[model samples]
Target: MKIVLPTAGKGTRLRPHTHTKAKSLVHVAGKTVLEHIVSRLASLDADEYIFINDDENGPQVMAFMAEKFPQLNCWATVQQERLGPAHAVSLAAPRINKGDDVLVVFNDTIFVTDLDRIPQLCADCDGLIYSKEVEDYQRFGVNVVDDQGLIVDMVEKPDTPVSRLAQVGLYYLKDGRGFMDFLEKTIQAGETVKGEYYLPAVFMNMIRAGLKLKAPTIDAWLDCGKPETLLETNRYLLRDRHHVHGEATDTVLIEPVHIEKGAVVRNAILGPNVSVAAGSVITESIVRDSIINADSEVRAMILDGSIIGDSARLVGSARRMNIGDHSLVEMT
Candidate 1:
């Protein structure tokens, strides 16, 4: 089995940070989003990984991967056009073997689960999809399954959905043939909406054609789509702060905070939940429930529920900003 992970999107919503590194490189809980995915997938029977990146930061992603996960055989493919997820998977066709099982995971979704059991679970099934019970299905693709847990239909953001089971960003395919064919047909037939082909349509076609698909609800999942949601995800994952690194001198730290090495803190209150990356300095500051990336500085400020990027300087700044890496701002 292999895993196809797409990290090519422009990530316009996660500005500043995305401006420099791939969105998958965004750090959460002392690890990048893509790193979390690869680590989880590594525990499975996955033979190799296919990482799809864009022209913007493809080399950087490969460099990061080499430094971090040298044991895994990771192959990188460039996507000239930033199409939908289905299209992104199509680019992996040349690398993927026919009739081989492949797991397609979204780069931004930080899933916490026993992934080692997923390949075994899906081996007996034709395809497997993950779902979650959401209050509102209008914003996500909804899956309608039969009593036997076999998905019958999937409606993308249906106004009136039969089930609140929303599609999470995990999919197991027995073969990538149908997925690639679907993308080609959808694009050739000119059935695209808003200039992008959707992956749900492929699943819908497969379901209608009598292909068995299973939907297994996960225990915990986080969508790092927007700034607020990203912050929430970090807080939720920070339940254990033992692994977080930070040097404290007369500093008070609350539970669930990650202070990386080379970060110096003095007389500062850090975290009910927070992540301060390496080389960052925190002095006489109050940081709670936030993510501070590498090489950032915080002094004499109250930072709550914010995402501070690398090399960012915050002094007496209290404004809520989703800043990018290496940005400097001084507050009085």
Candidate 2:
């Protein structure tokens, strides 16, 4: 089985953090997003690994793979153009064979599913596409299935209430070469939306050709696209509350908080959806619903709904937070 991960998008929503590193390298819940994703899929034991990275992030990804997944046969390649998803996947055609089982997953969103069972589950089908039932269907590309639960069509941000099974970016093709040929034809046909070809078009064309593309359901879809979702994923991951490093020194730690090794917290209240990464210090501050990245210092400030980047120094005085009765003073 060949596993492909496309990390080409330079997470502009993540700002200063992504400016220096790839979006997948962004730290969350004591690990990089890429690390969490790779670790989760480690059990699959894929035969080959293909990482689609941007030009600037290729070295970083390769370095990460060398350290984390050194035993696996991995190759890092760059997506020379930002045309679309189909174009990005096409870059791996050189490494793909006709009958190889290809599994393409986007790195921004991680889904919870038993990937080990996929081979047996899709043995009778030509391909599989994982989707989740979402209420906000218009915000994503949804898959339309027939009575047999096979994908018949797909609509990107539909005008009406088409389908709630939002495609969460996990695709498996039993015939990898057929998928690549469809992608090439998609590019040649000039079938594009917003000036770029999309993966839905390729899959739809494959379905039209009598391919049984089954739409399977996933357990959970955790999106790490932007800051809000990154923090949200942090909270979701920290649900395993055993992450606290010894007893807090002069600090009160709330549950569901992850304090990594080497993070010092003193005279502060932290928790209930917070993660203090390694090498960070927090003193005389109340941090909640936020992620304090590595090598950062937080002193004497009330931080909530915030994300402190790596090596950032944040200092503020809380003495002026005192306000009289009946006055609601909220920091924006």
Candidate 3:
């Protein structure tokens, strides 16, 4: 099987941090978002890994992958234009062989699931889409399944939802060439929503051509596109994998917090959902539900639901903040 990852988005929602690094590189729970996604696929045997990225950060992503996953056959292509997901996947067509099973994942979302079952599920259908039952169906693209449990239609942000099964950012296609063909047709037809071709539109086209796609449920889907979602994802991850390996002298350590090696904490109350990266220092502060990046420092502050970037320094009495890398903010 081959893997296709679309990571070219500018991540305008994740501002200052996205300005310095790719959205996938944002740290949460001691790992990058891309690392979290790749870890989920660790059990699978992939022949090739293709990443569609923006021109600016494409090389950086490739470099990171090469360093971390050198054994895998990884390739990166720059998406010069901010076309769309479908167009991004199309860029990897040259590398994928016909009849090959392909796994497509979006980089901005993190999901926890038993990925080993995907092959078997895809074996039973023409394609598979991982979905979660979400209350806010209007906020996401959803799969309209019939009574038989087969996806009949794909609707993007429907005004009146036909189904509650919102499609997560994961997909599997048993026939790679067939999907490529449909994607090409979708691009050629110029049938775009908001002037951009969507991957679901191609799936809908395939369904119209008699392809059967199945929707499978997952354990959880966490999005990291916006500030609130990113912070929530941080909390979710830290809740599962939290430990203190660094010094915290005279500090009140709350349960479920991660203080990485080389971090120093003193006279602080660190929390139920917090992750302090390596070399960061927290002194005389109260932090909860926050992520303090590497080499950052927080002094005499009460921080909650915050995301401090690498090498940032925050001092004073701010309750919440989103400080970017190498920034200095002194509030009173």
Candidate 4:
């Protein structure tokens, strides 16, 4: 099977951070979001890896993957117009095997599932979707499933939802060409709203064509789309670590803290749910429930539930701001 990772979104909700870097390249806990997803995909028997990214970030992505996951046969397609999810997938159809299964994964999602169980599940269905029950369905693409776990209906961000089984952006296509044909039909029928064609419409088309669609419940799934979501995901990852960091320090930690390698923390109360990425310095600061990205310096500041991006400098200042990657802020 081939893996297609769509990372072209500008992530407007993430603001200044997305303005500077691609959403998939956002750093959390010493690794980029794309790196985390690629590492997970490496566990599978993937024959080819296709990356769909925007023109602005294509070069950076190439250099990044070249150094990180060079073992895999990788190729990239540029989405020059920033059309939509369906259009992005259509750009890579020529590279994928027509009759083989293709796995479409969103770059912002951190997927954790039994990779070996996917092939068998896809054998009996035209398309297989991954779903997770969340507290609220209005914030996501909800799946209306029957008692037998079949995805009978889907509504993307409905005003009034009937179920909380949100689609987690992991899809298995038994035949890549068949799915593309449905997408084409949706376009021809003028079903697009807001000039963007969503992937859910394709599923509706398949249903109209009498194809069976199934939903598999996932064990772990996280969407790192916004800054708040990023911080939440980072905290969830650090929940079970006595000493999450690989590096050592004479400074004391208050438990449930993650200090990455090469991080120096002295006389600081780092705890509860703090993630200090590699090459970051945290000294004399009380940090809790936040993500401090790599190569940044934090000193004498109270960092709580904040995201400090890569190469950022935070000093003894008490002022707090929603900072982006490669920023510098100092206390006067």
Q: Write the per-residue lDDT of candidate 3 for residues 105-212, one digit (tens) a residue.
A: 998899988988876877757988999999989998899898777898888888996888998989999998788889999999997878888888899889888989
Cα lDDT of candidate 2 equals: 0.88
Window of ten residues with lowest summed lDDT in model 1: 237-246
Top candidate (TM-score): 2
For candidate 4, write residues 132-165 as lDDT tens digits: 8888878898888778667789988878868788
Candidate 1 structure quality by residue, lDDT tens digits, 1-332: 77888888878888877888888889887778877777777667578789889988888889999999888888989988866777887788777767767789987788776766765767666788888889878998888988988898888888886888888889888766665665577667665657776778777777767678888887777877678878888888887655545688898888877878888888899888788888988898988888889898889889888899988998874467888999998863
Count clashing residue pairs in model 3: 0
Pairs of residues clashing in candidate 1? 245-259, 245-260, 246-259
Query: Which regions of candidate 3 fall more than 4 Å away from where they truly are?
Result: 317-332
Rank all candidate structures by their TM-score, best first, as comma-separated numbers: 2, 3, 1, 4
Measured with C-alpha atoms, the lDDT of residue 52 in candidate 3 is 92
- Of the two candidates 2 and 4, the one with more favorable TM-score, higher being better, is 2
- Cα error, candidate 1, residue 230 (Å): 0.9
Q: If scored against the real structure, what TM-score would every candidate get?
A: 0.90, 0.95, 0.93, 0.89
In model 2, which range of ten residues has the least summed lDDT?
Answer: 239-248
Specify the highest-lDDT model's number.
Answer: 3
Pairs that collide in candidate 4 are none
User: Root-mean-square deviation of each candidate, in angstroms?
Assistant: 6.4, 1.9, 6.0, 6.3
**Candidate 4 ranges beyond 4 A from true positions:** 159-161, 242-248, 317-332
Find the number of clashing residue pairs for candidate 4: 0
Candidate lDDT (C-alpha), each: 0.81, 0.88, 0.89, 0.80
